[model samples]
Target: MSARLVLHGVCVGLLFAALAGAPTPAKAQKIYIETDLEGASGVYKFSQTREKDTPPNIEACEFLMGDIAAVVRGLRAGGAKEIIVSDGHGSQAFLPRLMEPGAKYVTGKPRPSSGLDETCDAIVMVGCHAMMGTPDGVLCHTQSSKSENRYWYNGVETGEIGQSAIVASYYGVPPILVTGDEATCRETKKFFGEHCVTVAVKRGLAREAAELYPFEETRKALFEGAKRAMAELPNCKPYQVKLPIQAKKEWYELDAKGVKGKLMTREGEILDLRDLYKF
Candidate 1:
C-alpha cells in the first residue's frame, strides 16, 4: 500500500463585501470528494481504463472530472467554504489537472485517524461502481480487480461506499452525495439512508456495456444534488454501524493463472472485516 498523502487544503478567504457586513465568513463547510474511473459518465467498458491501446484515457479522465467539477461547483454554490477531493482510485494519480481550485486533493487511500479526521462535514463519492457479481454492476469489483473476491462488513455485503462510510462515521461524517451507475445508487441508498443524495450517470446493460445519460445532464444533476444535499445536511445522518464490527472475505485471485484469470471474476467466501476497524 502507498503511504499517507494529501495536498494542501483550499483556504476559504473572506470576501471583503460579505465580511464587512457579517460578523465573520460563515463557518467553512469542509467536504471530502472521493472518485474512481468505472461508472464515470460516458464510460462504457473497461478498456477505457484496462487497455492502453484504446482511445486516450484522457477522454475518460475528462468525463470523470466533469462530474467532480460539477459537484464542487454545487458545493460552493450551496455555501461550502472548503473542499478536499481525494484521488481515491487507481494509483491515486488521476484528477490533478481537473480538481477544483477551491478544494484540496488527497492522493492516497485514507485509513481511520489518518489525514481525514472528525472535522469533515460530509463525504462525497464520484464514479463509484457496485460490488462484485452485481448482475447490473458496471465494471464491478471491490477495491481491487484482482486480489480480493468479496468483502463483508458485519456480514453485510458492501463495496467502497460502505467501507468508507463506516470509517467516516467514526469521525461523525455522513456521506451525503454519491454519483455513479443506477445499481450503485441502489447500494448507496441501502447503506446510507435514502436521504443521502444520489445522481446516477449511467445504467448498466452488462459488465462491459452501459447506457449513459447525457453528459451535460449528469453533470448538472450532480451539481444540483450536492447543492440540495448541503442545504439539508441536517437530514444526512451519519450511518452508525456496530463496533467490534466483524468483516469477512474470501481469497481466490491468487490461485488464478495471473491476476486477470477466472479467479479475478469469480466470487470467494466471506472473511472478517472487523480487524480493519481496530484503529
Candidate 2:
C-alpha cells in the first residue's frame, strides 16, 4: 500500500576513478534490493516468521532490518547512486524507524511490482531462503511454506531466489548479490552463477534448525558482500528462462476443517516472466 522513493548522493568524483580516464564521468548505479524474513539472521524457526505481530516475529523483523541496514550502508559506500529496498516477505516485515537512510523502503501489500525497471543496474536479494525440499535449508519453502508449495519452470525446480531473478531479467536487471543461509547461498550460485556475490549468515541443520552466526560478524560480512557485489556487477547476468514457460505448481489443498488434504497440481504456460508469481 505505501511506496516512497528517497534519493541520496554519493561521492562519484572519487568512487568512479577507474572510469576517470574516460571523456565523460560514468553515471552512478541504481540498485534494487528485495528481502524476505525466513532467512534473516537469528531467525531459523517458523514461529518467528509464520505469525505476525508476535514477540518472536517482531524480533525477527528487527533482525531483518539490521541486515538490510548493513547492506544499504555498504551499497552507498560502494558508490551506488540510488537504492530501493522491498519487503518480499509474505507478512511484510519492515520497521521504518530502523531503516538505513541511504535508500527508500517499500513495504505493505498489493503493490504493483518490486519497483525494479530497466534503469536499475542490478538487483539484490537479502534475507532470502532456499526453495522447498532443500534438506539443509532452514525455514525453506517456495511461495507458501504452509501449503508445502513447489514449482517447476520448464521442468527445472526453482526457488524464490531464481524466481525473483527471472522477473528482474524481464527488466534487464542482473542479480548481483544475495544473503541468506548456506543452502540459500548454494541455490543462488546454482542459478545466478558464482559471479553473483552471496553472504551466508548461518549453516542450516534442518528446516527449523541452524547454526546461526553472531549478528556482529554477519553484519560485517553482509557489508563486505554488498561492496563486492558492486565490483561483481559486470560479471553477473540476468537469469533467463525460455518462454512461454511450461509451469507446474504442486501444493496441498486445505479442507473445510482448515487441515491440509490431498495434494493439488496446476499446469500452465507463463507467457510473461513478470507474472511468474501469479502462475
Candidate 3:
C-alpha cells in the first residue's frame, strides 16, 4: 500500500476505536407520586359523592381520577421508567381502576413512618390541600377534618406539604413537584422553596367558594407540572428536619386523669402525651 493511504487508514481506525469507547448517556430515573383526592381539580367538599342527594356543585371522584391519569401519562412521556403512587387522603380509597397499567398504588392509612421515601428519585404530590387554618384554602384541614391538630418541628407550625417533605427527606429524596389549590401551592412553595414546581388548580374563597378550572385544563396543568418537575430534578434539594425530634400533644377531650404511664416530663399544668401514649 502507498504510505499516504496507509497513514489515512490508521487514522480512521483510531477515530472509530475512540468513538466506540465513549460512554452512553444514563437513562432518566423513575418518579414516585403521592396523590390526595381533596385538592384535586373541582373538589370543594369533604364528601366524595356523585349521586342523588349530593350537592349540586359537588366535584366528582371520576374527574379527579382523570387528572391523576393525565399526570401519570405525562410523567411516562418525560422518561419515567417506573411509578409508585400512594393514595394519601381520607379512607385512601377513591379511584382504583383509573390508574395507568403497571403502576403500583398504596392505599389505606399509612403508618407514622410509612409513606413516600428513599426508593424514589423524585416525589410529586397531586390534589393536596393546605394545612389547617390556611386563609382561603379549600377544606383546609391538616390530617383530619374533626381534629384541630398542629404539627410542629422545633416550634414551627409545619403544614401538610411540609410534613410530607420531611418524610421524603428522611430517605434522602427531594419533593420536586406539588399540585393543588392556589393556597396549597403557595404554601408548598413557601415550605419547600422556589425550586419545587407547583401547579394550582383552583382559587379558594372562604374554603367553599372558589374559581375552579374544568377537568381538561387541570389535566393539562398537571401534565406540564410533572414534566417540569422531572426536568428540574437535579436542582431539587432534600428537605431536612434538624434532629432531636420532639412531639407534644395537648388533649382537648381525652381524659388525662385516666391516663396511666411513666411520665417523661411535665411543663406547668400541661402533660406531653407522648409519655403516656404508646404507639
Candidate 4:
C-alpha cells in the first residue's frame, strides 16, 4: 500500500482500539476549535444583507453559532475536557452567546501570536472553504481581503486550511477534525494527509450556489466526525513540514519583494520566511 494509505489505515486501527479498550484516558484533552462563518451548513453568499452590499445576515449568524454548539457537544461526548473555540472568520465575532458555556471563546481579531495554534493538544477547523483559485469554492481567499490572491508553501498552492495546519504542526498540535464544503475537505486532506476527520456539510454548485445538508443533519455529522477524530487521536500524526520554511505570494499586481523573503520560484513566490504568524 502507498504511504498515505498506510497512514490512513493506522488511524482507523487506532480508533477501533480505543473503542475496544478500557475507558478513554481520564486526563482531559485540550481541543482548540476554529470556525469561519462562510462555510456554515446553509451559507451561500457571505454577506449579511439580502441585497448586494450589506453586512452578514442575522439568521446566518445564528446558524453559525448553532453549528459551533453542535460541534462542541460532540467534542464533549468524545471526551474532550477543555475546549477553546476561536471565532476564526472575518472580524472573529460571528458566534455570540450560543457556543457551549464551558468552552472558552476567543473572539475578535487576535494578534499574530494569539492564533489558533498555541498550547493546544488538538485543533479543529470548522466552516472553512478551499484556498484561493479553487473552482467553485465559496468566498475563497488566503488571508487578506485583497492584493495577494494565491499563497504557496514549499511551492504548493494552499488555502486557509493549509496555513492553519502548518501553524498547528509548528506547536505539535494535530488537526483532529475539519468541517466545511466537500472541496475544502478534499483540499485539506491533500495538504495535511487523511489523519483528520472531515465532515462535508455542503457541496458548492457554483460560487454562489451549493447543495447543503439540512442544518440538523449537518450538526449530526459534525458531532459524529468529532467523536471519530478523538477516538483516533493516538494514530493521528502531526502534519509536519520541514523547518526553514518558504512562502510565495501570487499577487495580481505589484512586485513580490514588497512582502518578506526573496523570490525562489519562477512563479514569483517568496522564500525563507520568519515563521507564519496570524490567521
Q: Which candidate is the best by lDDT?
A: 2
lDDT of 2 at 55: 99
**RMSD of each candidate?**
12.5, 10.6, 7.4, 9.5
lDDT tens digits by residue: candidate 3, 1-279: 999999999999999998899864434466778877778888786555223225432245566677778788877777778888777765554467676674677776546744455667888888888988887998787665454455556556667787777767767788888988999988988888898999888999977667888877888888888877777777898877666455443222323664333423222311322221221
Best by TM-score: 2
lDDT of 2 at 188: 93
Write candidate 2's Cα lDDT for 72-98 as tens digits. Answer: 988888789899999999889999889
Provide the TM-score for each candidate, comma-separated: 0.79, 0.90, 0.76, 0.79
Order of all candidates by TM-score, from best down to worst? Answer: 2, 1, 4, 3
Error of model 4, residue 276, in angstroms: 1.3
Clashing pairs in 3: none
Total clashes in model 3, counting residue pairs 3 or more apart in sequence or in different chains = 0
Give per-residue CA lDDT, model 1, range 25-96, as digits (tens): 454378888788787898867767665334557678778888888988999998898888877667443657
Off by over 4 Å in 4: 1-21, 49-56, 110-118, 145-148, 253-274, 277-279
lDDT of 3: 0.71
lDDT of each residue in 1-279, candidate 4, tens digit only: 999999999999998998988675654378898888777888887464232223456667677787788888888898888898887766554546565666888776545544455457788888888877677776666764344467766667778887777777767788888888998888877876777889988898776678878988999998888888888677666777665556566545435554443323323323322256421
Off by over 4 Å in 3: 1-28, 49-59, 109-115, 246-279
How many clashing pairs per prediction, in order? 9, 0, 0, 4
lDDT value, residue 119 of candidate 2: 88
Task: lDDT for model 4, please.
Answer: 0.73
How accurate locally, in lDDT, is each candidate?
Answer: 0.75, 0.92, 0.71, 0.73
